[model samples]
Target: MYKHLVVAVDGSATSLNALQHACSLAEMSNAKITLVHVANPSEYMAMAPEFMHHASYEEAAVAQGNEVLDFAEKAVQEAGLSDVVKHLLVANKGARDMAQELVDYADEQGAELLVLGTHGRSGLMHLLMGSFAETVMRQSHLPLLVIRSQKDEDE
Candidate 1:
């Protein structure tokens, strides 16, 4: 029933799974796919010492983000999805607001579904890093399908 689908990727296996799932759903429903990769340079810039090169750090992050998107798009195309779109966004740094940006972009694009994967972090790791999927679920109105990471499922 969904016509527009948004899938977020970050060059992680979990995200790769999400992309594959999105591709299958899109193919089945004849929906369009939008692959989004967000580059938040602020975290890197802030953490680097003043002596380190800032421009190179930001450039590397953007390049990596684009690579992630490229890989995701390739996988989708191989899955027989034709109407696929890609977006590489530079989000505000340090706020851990990628969730809000993804939600906003999906809404702006009139996406019917937002698909992503959770690393299933817990304990200290969860407390320190937080969870993007949880944030998006709490803030977005669009339907979400969050796939657990294979590692998590195995455990």
Candidate 2:
């Protein structure tokens, strides 16, 4: 049984599904769930080329972190996960990747399990943007539960 379940939510349907999965697993194991949202620095850099500007992508990411954390907290509450905590991870500061940041967070929090949602993007989309779910799987040392979209699972 997992003592601590770590869940990453990105505001996608797949992320929501992952949240649900985490809640279920927590309920089953009688464990605590920690919800995290990684604010991708690359995403912000891509959005605004002026990386030094205070109003640039970097600053935006820090602020967005709170928003994503709030969403995750709402999700946990809505899922009726009583023993859950929401965590906001700011990954823009010297972090290699969003996934790496999440893995470190889990370690810092002493979480035993990691859960993620897959977008199932392939080809150009996947090549250009990269995949958070894949990154998490590769970097995490703990047990991982990846929930793909319904259509992808069906296929």
Candidate 3:
């Protein structure tokens, strides 16, 4: 079974769902898990294109990522993830595409599997907007477990 699992989380409900799923899978498999949050480099690059040459934007992204990562860690801890290890990744703009980044992270962490949430966007919307999860799914070298998005409760 999967011994090393990598879970990519983004604080979305879908991601949280996948996180819970990942935790359960880890528990059942007695596997080591790594919870990772990739601070989308696009956020910083889109906000400060000119600052790409400097470390300010990258630093800010990592700082913000740390907060999100902390929240994720709290959640995994609350779930009682005993064999899980967490890695908070903050990729700067020009670092890599989301898919490549996730793959690299998994490889670097020696994860045998990747778990993630999908937004379920498709058709013209998907073509126009694109999704990180989709990219990761298309490119990941390891086995990926995808949790599809659930419609909003009110919807």
**Rank ordering of all candidates by TM-score, starting from the highest:** 1, 3, 2
Model 1 per-residue lDDT at 77: 86
Task: Provide the clash count, candidate 3.
Answer: 0
User: Which sections of candidate 3 miss by over 4 Å?
Assistant: 45-55, 93-96, 153-155
Model 2's alpha-carbon lDDT is 0.79
* lDDT of residue 25 for candidate 1: 91
lDDT of 2 by residue, 1-155 (tens): 89899888877778888888888888888899888887765566655455454565657776777677788787777877778787777675443467888999999999998998887879998888677778778888888899987775525
lDDT of 1 by residue, 3-99 (tens): 9999989888889988888988998899999999888876566564765543666776688788899999899989988899999877765425788
Q: Each candidate: what lDDT? A: 0.86, 0.79, 0.77
Candidate closer to the true structure by TM-score (higher is better), 1 or 2: 1
Q: Which stretches of model 1 miss by more than 4 angstroms? A: 46-56, 152-155
Better model by TM-score: candidate 1 vs candidate 3 = 1
**Which pairs of residues collide in model 2?**
none
Best-to-worst order by lDDT is 1, 2, 3
lDDT for each residue of candidate 3 in 1-155, tens digit (9 for 90 to 100)? 89998988777888888888988888888888788878765576567566565467667667776776677778877888767666667655432465687789898888999999887887987887787776787777788899888888113
